[model samples]
Target: MMRYILVGILALMVLAVGLLSFEWYRGQNQAVAFGAPFELVDDSGQPITEKAFQGRPTALFFGFTHCPDVCPTTLFEMEGWLDELGEEGEDLQAFFITVDPERDTPEVMKTYLGNFSDRVTGITGDPEKVAAMAKAFRIYSRKVELEDGDYTMDHTASVMLLDRNGDFFGTISYEENAETAVAKLRRLINEG
Candidate 1:
């Protein structure tokens, strides 16, 4: 009877271990599947694809040029991060995707990004395409009208970090300091 009890306990332990291993594997697979493919026109009106970002860490943000405050602040933070990274910053690419595609034409994108850094790239596309991409990235952006004929966009102010293989590594909140963001980005690049 003692021998039977020992055998049952061993079987239960093995089952538990198997279940834990399966769960871990599932979690890893989900992480690997984080990002989806997207296509848009770059500042120069050239077609850009997920393949373009492959083998390089990418920092992605969604905003419009018409943004009054948050957008410029975020871009300035990114510039500071690049300065912190120095030469290593070249290895990382920054993409600014405009949520207000109706107004953010390729020319506008180019000019807006130029204020931050030449290293920064701007992307805009058809409204439907931009909306779909924003949905995929879980970005929230909405247009808010003001007394003036112009409008402003209210968007989530988080920067997304994509791994070298174009997987969604993680994000840095807008509230984070430039130093903190740079450290996180460097760690992501090194790990990848």
Candidate 2:
């Protein structure tokens, strides 16, 4: 009876693995999608919104200029993927929206993003506006005080993708390969 029970458990485990593998292979549930809207200030200080993304698919990342690792790393990876995409990249817009608006003024955003891909544009605004924008995008962010009285932002590190119509597209994982991102962008370009 113990042997039979073990066999049953083994069979269930195999079935579970098979189902999960199939789901992964089918490429379903790859991202949490949102068609949310936002209003913030552009690098040039113009008021911006989803209207800016109407004609092209966009990748949006939320963080602050103070992030030491994940923020820059993700921006670099996105840059690499865009480089690999060539012209297809031209049809896409990339945004770096700041959660720490107090310190991420338009000028500060410009200088910070200049260190990364020029293809990306940075946006910031008042604290309330920033909070509303983050909420609209379903982004979670908060300020954390370090031991030295300095502060850093803790935020969701996911890259959000939106289609040309400013509709919910799919999200690209931080660990996703450049090829995957390129393929998704190509699909969006073709579909756009």
The lDDT of each candidate is: 0.87, 0.84
Predicted candidate 2 versus true structure: per-residue lDDT over 1-192, tens digit per residue: 999999999999999999999999776654444545667788778888778878888888888888899888998998888888887568888999999999999988888888887889998998997898788778899889999999998999888888887776768877677788778877877784
Model 1, C-alpha of 51: deviation from truth (Å): 1.7
Pick out the ten consecutive residues of candidate 2 with the lowest summed lDDT: 28-37
Q: Lowest lDDT 10-mer window, candidate 1?
A: 31-40
Q: Candidate 1: where is the Cα deviation over 4 Å?
A: 1-15, 18-33
Give RMSD to native, each candidate. Answer: 2.7, 7.2
* Model 1 lDDT at residue 36: 58
Clashes of each: 0, 0
TM-scores for every predicted model: 0.86, 0.79
